[model samples]
Target chain A: MLVLSSPSGAGKSTIARNLLENDKGFELSVSVTTRPRRSSEIDGVHYHFRSRREFDNLRANDELLEWAEVHGNFYATPREPAERAMNEGRDMLFDIDWQGAEQLREKMQGDIVSVFILPPSMRELKVRLQRRAEDDAETISRRLANARNEIEHWRDYDYVVINRDLDRAYQQVLSIVAAERLRRDRSLGLFDYVTRLLDEQVD
Target chain B: MLVLSSPSGAGKSTIARNLLENDKGFELSVSVTTRPRRSSEIDGVHYHFRSRREFDNLRANDELLEWAEVHGNFYATPREPAERAMNEGRDMLFDIDWQGAEQLREKMQGDIVSVFILPPSMRELKVRLQRRAEDDAETISRRLANARNEIEHWRDYDYVVINRDLDRAYQQVLSIVAAERLRRDRSLGLFDYVTRLLDEQVD
Candidate 1:
């Protein structure tokens, strides 16, 4: 599991999109949510849109990896798909907040490699937020304020990438994924591999 | 600290050489030894030639990060150079054996990122040893046996790279280095940088 957290406008969504489009090896961990889906959103693709009762049951049964309540609607990462993907030897990418990241880490510490993307500076972050032009001035200001709260949690991540240059930051994330895949604890096939190597004949 | 360990002829030396030559950010942590230096080997560039008395003194005083006796001669990594490199914000590479790697990890658990390289197969390893033509058939056979002993310690490393293709293996190591550099604990400056970021004004 790969978790990426960033303050809004840090280019994390852009980086994560590039990774998934280019690397077919990863499957996105589609979250389950109680919020009603919009007309443009598709079920299971956008989110596993669940009823409030279903979301509550999933949480009660511990079927959710991590869950959050926002504005009285529930959002969660379903455990089944992520586990199945891992068992089938596929990597999973998660775009989650710091609190969700901590929960995932607690449940599955060894399998997860979390990265926090940082904007180059607060001023630059503000500039990017304003440039997006999708938000009102009040929402933009609120996001900037929330960015500091999120940025304070940067130290909790396994790796930190400063988005000074989008391409450079993306490449840094690629490196993290490649390197984590080589970790010995994660490579269970290595045992048989080394055994076969030692038993091989030499001329 | 970055340490690379592999059995002979597994392409570790070639990878380390290429990394040092291409990347100026790394400084080789040259080992100091009691063995007489070869005519072709420079004192500081290759190994720091030292007397047995001095080596013993350094080890006793905890001035050596790791020490071992090879063929009745003492070889050790000096603590000063490695620490100095870290203080200067430069990565230091150690081409050391498993025992040395263990010692380094014990001394500086948080700082060291060790990688173990494996030959593609035992048969391939034999071919590499024979191709080198540096030793007789008997010596090559003995080295092959020793390779298994060394390969068994692969679990001790944080990452493992199988040298199937030299370039790919090199890239994997490069990725490990890049990712490890971005580790939250290692980037000490991030704290102050984030502080400055939070305080910066946005208009």
Candidate 2:
């Protein structure tokens, strides 16, 4: 499991796309949200857009592993699908925060490996957020303030990558995901099956 | 930081040495212990062999992070020296158990990545122990029993690698260390420095 969380415009969305495009075993988890879609965003593909009432129902039904309100809107992961993917030995990638990562960790045992992406600096973060030209000045100021608070919880993650250089950050995250997949606890079945042949030779 | 732990003759020592040889920026932490030196072992290089009285004094004074009695001998890490190395930006590697790893985590605010090496199987573990040809059959049995208990704490570790195929296991560990060293928090200075350049350009 891999969770790549950062403030908006931190290049995590780009990094996530490249990772899923390159890696065969990984599936990007599409989140459901009540947030309004941007001009380029698509439903059921970019996000599973739902009404506030539906999101509220999911929260009430205990269906979400983790959920959060952002900019007066809601977003969440449907718990069952993610668990089913993990159980079948597929890796799921999440673009979420500490709250979601923590909840996922509790539900899964030794599977979640959270990586927090830090912008080069608060100044650079503001620049990147501004470069998008999507949010207004007030919204950008609000985001900068939120980013600082989010980054303070960087210690909660298993790994952290500063997105100063996009190529380097992408390569670092790719290596982490690849290395984690080969962990002995996760690949025990492969080891056991191979060792049986060696056992037969000895017997 | 990476800690590799396994029972004696489980090939963890060999794996640790291989990782050290191939990886740059990783230094093996030389431990100070009160154990009698084997004929082939070197002093100060392998271990700082201390007197029982000195070991007891260090343990009593709280200089040692974690110490354990095994076969009537004591072994521990002097916390100050290890912290100095880490503070100097060196990734100190440990060939220690879950107990020592836990102790290090509690005392230090640095990152800890533990890898538990599993023998191919219990049968192979027994074979590997017997192949050591150092211990008698009774001692080998005791070591095998101990390995089982150690493996039970596999969940406590962040990563696990099985030495089924030496080359594969070595590569897996190498990749993990490489990825961990690139963690964002440790590279914060680099990010801040780079961001300053960008800030200057914009101004």
Candidate 3:
């Protein structure tokens, strides 16, 4: 599964949506969460919203692939749905953060391919954060601090793309995904299936 | 299974070799052939030479993923060794033609990610062919004709990268492979394995 993780305002979600729109083969892996939805958020679309108790129950039962808490609310990935999609040969795209990515990587086989988006510099990060106009100075400051912590984990990912230019970064992300699909380990089963036919001819 | 295909002088082999030298995880899929070895070629490294009878035997049994004739000599991809490498979690890189890619994709479920390397223009391609200091003008012209025919298969590939500048193209190729590794369908089994552990937990 391809998990794209970046700090808030780094444009990971936008990139993921663009990739999904361009590639019909990709399926977005919607995360489930215990946090209350914003007015615009749609249940089962933006997220599968469960109550805190239900979320806790799911976690306790091991149904969640990976889960974590931020500001007292829990967010997680539902294990079953992603598996069903993959088994059906659909690729899943995840827009997440480093913490969630770390958890997902650990719980899964080394199948998780991760990419970290980085702003060109601290100055550029602040410029982008301010451009969003969604947060005030204080909130932006807090976010910038958190962003530093997140970017620190960039080394953990397979690719680190600097979003200095949106178009170039998007292309880089697309290329990475395209190349990964060709990975031999992922496609070895096809080799076996083809070899079986050869075996048939050998006898 | 990232297939990098281009015209005879497009430098795909050079890029593939560079990638192999730097990336330990990548295994070059050596082609099997019935052609005589040139003085510069090495057996089992550049290619595995086989007798016409053995080649016929492999073809009769469907052991080759793809096979074709060039200058009255035959070449093929031996299915078993490449498959084994991939099954063991290694990424295999193929420097083959479009026909080989098409055949391989048909026979197996390998990620089938193909990148067509294009010269900046016909003029550049001709210049590169001449710069090789090998073939005569007639051969170079024939190669250019062949390149145009081969490039018609670009739409069949997952990515199209123009090798205008070598370093930039190299980086783009690396980016493609890195992102592809993160594909969700490819990594789905990893997620399922992690979720299986949750089966023991109770709500």
Instruction: List TM-score per model, in order.
Output: 0.89, 0.65, 0.53
CAPRI docking class of candidate 3: incorrect
- Global local distance difference test of model 1: 0.88
Q: Which stretches of candidate 1 lie over 4 Å from their true place?
A: A34-43, A48-63, A71-73, B33-44, B49-63, B71-74
Which number leads on DockQ? 1
Candidate 3 structure quality by residue, lDDT tens digits, B1-203: 88899877777888899899998889999999998886778999999999999999999997888998866789899888778976787788988888888888887676667887766666667778899877778878777777767766666777766677888878778877766664444553534432342232211
Clashing pairs in 1: none
The positional error of residue B188 in candidate 2, measured at the CA in angstroms, is 6.3
Native contacts retained, all candidates in order? 0.86, 0.32, 0.23
The candidate 3 chain A region of ten consecutive residues with least summed lDDT is A194-203
- The number of the candidate with the highest lDDT is 1
Ranking by DockQ: 1, 2, 3
Which of the two candidates, 1 or 3, achieves a greater DockQ against the reference? 1
Which ten residues in a row are the worst by lDDT in model 1 chain B? B66-75
The TM-score measured for candidate 1 stands at: 0.89
lDDT of 1 by residue, B1-203 (tens): 88999988899989999999988989998999998886667998888899989888888898998898754888899999898997787889999888889988888778788999999988888989999876789978878777887888988998999999999999999999889888888887888988898888884
Q: Measured against the native two-chain assembly using Cα atoms, what DockQ does each of the candidate structures obtain, in the order listed?
A: 0.73, 0.20, 0.12
Docking class of 1: medium
Whichever of 1 and 2 has more lDDT, that candidate is 1
